[model samples]
Target: MVAPTTPGTTPTPTNDAPVADAAARLNRLADGYLVTAALHVAAELGVADVLDRGACDAERLAAEVGARPGPLSRVLRLLVAEGVLVEFPDGTFSLTPSGRLLRSDVPGSLRGVVRARGGVYATAAPALAEAVREGGVAFERARGEPFFEHLAQHPAELAAFQASMVDRSARAAADVLAVYDFGRFRRLVDVGGGFGVLLSAILTATSGVSGVLFDRAEVVASARVPEGTEVVAGDFFAGVPAGGDAYLLSWILHDWDDADARRILTRCREAMGPDGTLLVVDAMLPERAADGPAVIRLDVTMLLLATGCERTGREFGELFASAGFTLRRIVPTASPLGLVVLEAVPA
Candidate 1:
């Protein structure tokens, strides 16, 4: 039955339950920051690592991690609700399979990522609206310094950031090896290859292929590369290491906008021989939003953090053309990070 209304008045809805339900869902979506904060707290406290030994009540866990019992218990309950942990009948909580990834000592660990998200990235999130209204990088605007510059000043945060990259590259390296033939190249130069995770993996997989790991002096100072692999430190904008049949730009170009990306490509073009292959490992933004939700989300992160963007295949092609290279092929990788190897050759 419909409600009656005056001639000039709007009628009331017969059912408000669906509207209320939709509002509830929207509210949950808006509260996502709370989840991120909770995860960050857990990561900082090393909850997953402590629980790896055995399930324990929050009070004891709090004692181990130097947190308040009641508050930590509430946070643990929230994690259990979020499926990162499971509560036992006896009231102790245990890590779920997904929660195990938060352990700092484990392979594919995301503790560093959680810390980064909850720390440095979270600090920049509030400025997103301002950035949209006033054109500027959200992170720099919020922190009063560039992303890399800030990281350079904060060694602990830099380590967390680097660890996150290592985890991502470790996962992507296997997928890259599976899809691409690194054995074909005589010398492979990994430009801006932080920590040499991907470069070392390639050298191990491909025999007789010498490698050069290049990046900023500070970054390459602590890098661990395979035996006989040369490590050089320099600005990619100024120049890159030369004399390689293959120049690898793994996870680099997307950190800058088109103009800077083109400059990087130009440098790579100058550094390599006429027949050298340029392999760019990055996430290719899908034409449709629904097709690559993760990549789209990363694009937003890039907007918030740096003067960079994830681009579609057409954009990459255009950028390559501007830098005297032809887009040869984009080899898809099975990496969960949504990475693809964009192979190019000099024009």
Candidate 2:
């Protein structure tokens, strides 16, 4: 296979592998990225909404978006073949089931995700190798600044990132809740919970469960506090909200390394009542290190864009114990987001 020669590098067609394999990999990378860009543009143009009502040919759809049909047709054809759209014999196309994810109207949809990815995350993807060697996101190298700092400077991009996370939390939270039992806790705190979707889902599913959402000051400044939920502004690395019977960190730990994760966990441990529980909602890889590439690959993805890594259940057991939280149970969630509930007391 052709390897990227440098960070922020694209592997060009080369003589390393057999002609066909090299060509295929390079083509897949280049074409796939182009397709990613297409999805971004389609989501931005509200093409899914246009197609949601009915099918329209490229010319009409392009006209709706005030773009030329010739260029737009190429994108439509590529997406149709990719099952994002269904093409009719007459050349008009309609949205597919996957296309629903591109609509911003639906809860848990990927509209914001695709937009943010195509907008900002894509810029960081190519620099993945540098990030791997450097132990943090190559955002600085890629964009000349820290990720959150860049977000702070660009309000619109920050909004897009938060919206993307909020939408994505819905897509994964239901399956997550399905896999974990919320029967043990009365009140919970969501550290870095964007829009409190996961906490709301947990509370909505379990009776008499109230929750608190702690996030950045600006991020939570305008967040609507849903019924039975309180929203607060705080830093996770510094500390978190207090007085909850249980604490929850959903996909938050994966944004930081072991040290930062330990600090955050220590904060929660300090804040928890003697009987309080801590539920870490994350993707816990398998106990044995041999059977999976998905977990490790995603860890690599995190390394490329953030300073984090996915840990195995055994790793969690070790990490939890170190942070003064006991590993009580590792519950498997329905989706990739696994649930590992730890407690303040020893197991």
Candidate 3:
């Protein structure tokens, strides 16, 4: 009979252990889509919110979420294994730390992101093969239109995407404000600023500085800003309002290809004073794939959603140089989205 190893001692390496571990990892990678689909279903059904009050058995959870007990229970069990939920001996489930993020009322809730990925982006994933074969957005290929055009046509989808952006930006804005000094600039123009949420947050953070929220006519028209901030409507590709000491392109440049990105930057350059600062807040990819899987994932999403791509610092530097701006420095932030504040100035 084989003897069991002591708790504190290392077990003798079996030749099969490493191979088994590798196979497990590979299997997990293969099954990743299942996790995403389950999370989407949970977010859509408000399962997290249902459990927010207290733990509940699968049958009760199903009743509250309007799902069948059998399937819902299985999904919940999967979530339990995934660490998003904790299953008790009595067969009741409660939220885990990660699970709390799905609640709508939470401070940094990712409910919007969950909905967007599952409902909108998931449907576009299969078209990625087509996108690679051709040279356009997979979303365009799947849905018969570009991402924004599709959003414009469908109000529900548009609302969900907007909400997702807000959810993403809300966390990022705080992280940005922590690292970047918005107080240094007098007049800051937020180009392509949606709903002025980030701008409002910035302005609130810095009392001395005023800001302009620039976006589409409809977007700016509905935007609510603090007293010192202004909401302006126009196409950024055409021109931006002049005389701002600082220009912000938050979560903007990643939506287009190099040509379009250059055009947008050119517009900013034209609008910017010689000494004006240009701050671009976007996801920056790391050199090592292991360092930034989330960024790489988003890059794939961009490949499918728009004619855009996430860039490295070198790529961004090249892009800025092409637009007659010299890259100053890329500031890192604490946001989980891996947002980098890229600062530049007109050449």
Candidate 4:
């Protein structure tokens, strides 16, 4: 039988019903585990990195990652559905632009995130129901400790977590650098900026901008931040580094409760210059769904995994207002992530 057609309108056959139906079935949310595991494995194995040199059969990639060809080929085919890779009739494969992101050395590499989800993030998924039930973080159910406490216990995992934020910042940085004029700012303090990825990205792009990366002592020690970065180890709850023209936090507030987040922003408010800018880089939990699913999934994941939850534009405005800073502007960046700018003017 032929697929149904509706006049000039294309009768787009939705769902798994084609020759590639078996794999498409796995790709759909019906088999969440299949896609989840496949993403982790492919990202971990550096399939994109390996294939970047040239296309070869599955056996070669498995050899590079120290795995078995039989199993790896099945994984590669899974990604092919998502456009991460492609297989031709001759039996070899190649990279698509989307797949290039998994390469560890790539500019916007998400290899760390890919590896992380299979580990901690995977564990956290099950806690979503618990968190929704209790109205608190479900990290304990996932890691048997609070998010920060777990980070303290597994130093390496925490380090990788920080690095992944930097990896993400590379993409957001390009947008920040392009849209915002940093020439007027003399100093920038990256409050809870993780491994200084956002700070490094912004500073590297803006000449004559000095930076202070404030975080826990352990996190600061682990960040292999690039040049001209001063590491200040302290809790954002206590106080941020002083004398900066700007204070920034990327994906930081979503890791804490509103009261704590407000307290942290208050510190930033106290530290800034009279006309300083405070920038927050992370997803703004939309009042209604955006045209995509990434942010929605990420917001829910934050609800399950951390003490924080993603916020809407108004939610951010309230947080900044409570912290004694005024919400200035909301700039949609080059990436899906948006930037929220709050200003501290003399009262």
Best by TM-score: 1
**lDDT per residue as tens, model 1, 159-262:** 87787788778888889999998888999999999999999999999998999999888789889999999999999999998899999998898899999999
Where does the lowest 10-residue lDDT sum fall in candidate 1?
10-19
Q: Each candidate: how many clashes? A: 0, 0, 0, 0
Please give, for residues 1-347, the per-residue lDDT of candidate 3 as tens digits: 22468888866646776668879999999898899889988988999999999999999989988999999999988999899999999889999999999999578999988889887888799898877987777898889988887877777787678778888888888999899888889999999998887898899888788889999775676677898677789999899988899999998999999999999999999998899999999999879878988998888889879989899999999999999999999999987667899999998
CA shift of 93, model 3, Å: 1.4
Model 1: CA > 4 A from native: 1-14
For model 4, the run of ten residues with the poorest summed lDDT = 338-347
Residue range 1-347, candidate 4, lDDT tens digits: 23688799765646546537656766586777677788788876677777889998888778888899998899889888878888999888888887888888678788887777766677777776877787667777767788777887887678567666767777777877777777678888888877777777777777988888888888888776777689999888888889987887878888888988888888888887678888787777766776536778777777767768788888888888888877777877656654443343433
Off by over 4 Å in 3: 1-21, 221-224
- Most lDDT-accurate candidate: 1
Q: For candidate 2, list the clashing residue pairs, or say none.
A: none
Cα-based RMSD of candidate 4: 4.6
Listed in order, each prediction's TM-score against the native is 0.94, 0.86, 0.89, 0.85
| Per-residue lDDT of model 2, residues 1-347, tens digit only | 56558878766755656677758988887788888888988987888888887899999999897788998889888898788998999999898899978877686588888888888777888777776686557766798787777887888888878878888678667777766777777778898887777777777888877889898877877576567578888788788888888888888888787888899998888888778788787777666556555566556657666777788777777888888877877666556444444333433
Model 3 alpha-carbon miss at residue 59, Å: 3.0
